[model samples]
Target: MLAAEKSKKTRHVLGISGGKDSAALAIYLKQQGRVPEMEYFFADTGVELPEVYSFVEKLESWLGQPIVRLGSGKDFYHHLEMHEGMLPQATRRWCTQEMKLKPLEKFIGDDEAITYIGIRADEFRDGYLSLKSNVKPCYPFITDGLVRRDIFDILRSTVGIPEYYEWRSRSGCFFCFFQRRDEWVGLSERHPELFQKAMEIEEGVNRRFSNLKKPYTWVRGMSLKELIADAEAIKEKSALRKAREKDPRSWQEILISDRQDDENQACLVCSL
Candidate 1:
């Protein structure tokens, strides 16, 4: 209805994954008046960090627009059934397909939509998302030639980034298997219950796949139990490594660095 008959009015949609980049993008879009009526959404995996919710609330106030949350109503258990009890690994990421992408596709429906992505110019990964012909993907940050420093500056000038950055580098599901070894420790200490749930998922699934001895557990080599047991050593080493970076220090910066140091890339929408 917003666009004319021949024009095929495109729906302007921006997703806020409760991460700093997406939040900053929301602010940039509104402040720049790129699309005053841009629709914002957060695809909820239903197990995100509490700080994410609080951060989104702050962004909503700043953007003066509702960030509609599209949730997987059935949660992980429902999708797990569909995947036949096999836990999603990095190689076969069924979880992202079912929980993240499916919900988003449902929201757009048949509308001619412009999906704004927040892949910054400083980024090294390629998502290559969006297969829908009607849902054209656009990268505002990349097109604007805004890099990591620019994103940092925008977030700094605005809501100052989510507090979760103090602990975790990325934002997504609390039980996101992509979390670092030290982040698991942070999770256990900060949000014990959520950490417990994540560990249970690993333990239960590993037990089921014990016959094959699949090594695709949450972290690389160690189990959650082992990771927690070695938390002190890991945290101390992390502290030492972080002391070397000249930038302003935080657990988040350390985590981000750790993510880059390792070859593992976080999901675009989930981590922003």
Candidate 2:
């Protein structure tokens, strides 16, 4: 097995999701000089946040190498039409498969690639975005026992957190369905253009799906239109909740402490 695995043409590669963990992982690998020819790539969905693009540019400068940007041949609209206008949710993440992971697999071909996954020791979930057996995942952070603190330190010590963190918590497409209700409002305030585009996508989905045998929307329980309809109330409620939490850090601290109970973890390809 060792000989066969060794004979399988190894490729050292890392994927940058434009998130802190991936960015930090790139820095960590460079500092350690583990894989000098490590191929860094970022799969672009075209619908990604501008902040993501800007952050990637900064990270590229720091690493002194251009991180390859892999994009879906077909735009999001094309894919949405192909999937009968279904917006990808947590359960149906075709977007990741088609837009992100597939491009990565194509880049690697049949070569056995040691895919350096950026998942920290603090996160205990598996990613479903990649299914290439030749592309094996290696968690250096876990091996080194690095945690969230280490990841934050890497960002602070390097290019700094992506500006989007001021509003949205995760990085991916601007209209990523994984977003919380508050994140949608954050979009409205921070990047109204992107939010409008997202609203259009939602509208398209609603129109396309309403004609189908079943109905679907980007968000569960409410369409973007409905969400926007009650945007004022939602914002007020969110503000009240924030006030109820007493303060920002205290609220986050409580949530973090509560979420460490093994069930609150997310397994998406990016947030790792």
Candidate 3:
């Protein structure tokens, strides 16, 4: 048992990533009366969507506990400057390392801790496993055989899924590079200010990295400005894709299945 290997004081930690899976894990553990002393935390990047913040607040209420908010003390722009204005991409994710993982590691310090991750049974991807011997990663969802549907059910019965799910599938910074083309359009429509900021950042990166083989952008082969210019087409394509996948399945189920196709293309620490 987990308790058997416990040190004199082993911290039980669960990270809330402002995504459905982590939020559902928190609720699931509470319902199971497991890890009553779990320390819930959110590693804020300071640039997440307003909807993500709102969802976290709602989730805290449902858990009936104050979710500790941790940060690296520096914002995204600071990290961007430190990286010579280069935007973080899938291959190079300094953003997740500096803004998310480092803060989490600092919070845990050298203390022995069990970090509960929310990667579901259906997901073939692995969570961020720290090399620090003091920190151990745990996956209750997989152990209990809970999948995507079970995550949705937990949220629906408790705090409900994040509002951003109506448009974006995952949660992270508003300027996250993992955003789909349709999600970028959704950002432009729902949070124009944030979208503008993202565009400005992309433009700044492109200016600094002008010597690169291609222009740096949030979306590959295209800039946010260019993406927004083709918003109608993107929307039409997204709608058609949804129509093609539409059937007797619930919207949540459809989204879950569609997201699985690109499961390997995400930052586990930020998305899960």
- Candidate 2, residues 1-272: lDDT per residue as tens digits? 68776657688888888887789999999998988989899888888888999999999999999899988788988887787677888788888878887777788887878888876777676653456577777889988998877777777788986777665677888888777787788888888898888888777776655666555766788877788788888888988987996775743343334334221243345554
Q: Over the stretch 1-272, how does candidate 3's per-residue lDDT look in tens digits?
A: 46555544889999898988889999999998999999999999999889889999998998999899999999898999999888899888999999999999999988889999998887788887889998899999999999887888888889987878778877899988888999999999999999999999898888877898988888999999899999999999988977886777766666655545343577777878
CA lDDT of 143 in candidate 3?
A: 95
Q: Pick the candidate with the highest lDDT.
A: 3
Clashes of each: 0, 0, 0
Candidate 1 structure quality by residue, lDDT tens digits, 196-253: 8878888887777778655446777777888888999999988787677555756544
**Model 1 vs. true fold: TM:** 0.88
User: All models: lDDT?
Assistant: 0.78, 0.78, 0.87
Q: Using TM-score as the measure, what is the rank order of every candidate, best first? A: 3, 1, 2
Worst 10 residues of 3 by lDDT: 255-264
CA-only RMSD, every prediction: 3.1, 4.0, 3.4
- Choose the strongest candidate by TM-score: 3
Pairs clashing within candidate 3: none
Q: Give the range where candidate 1 is weakest over 10 consecutive residues by summed lDDT.
A: 255-264
- Evaluation by lDDT, superior candidate among 2 and 3: 3
Tally clashes: model 3. Answer: 0
By TM-score, is 1 or 3 better?
3
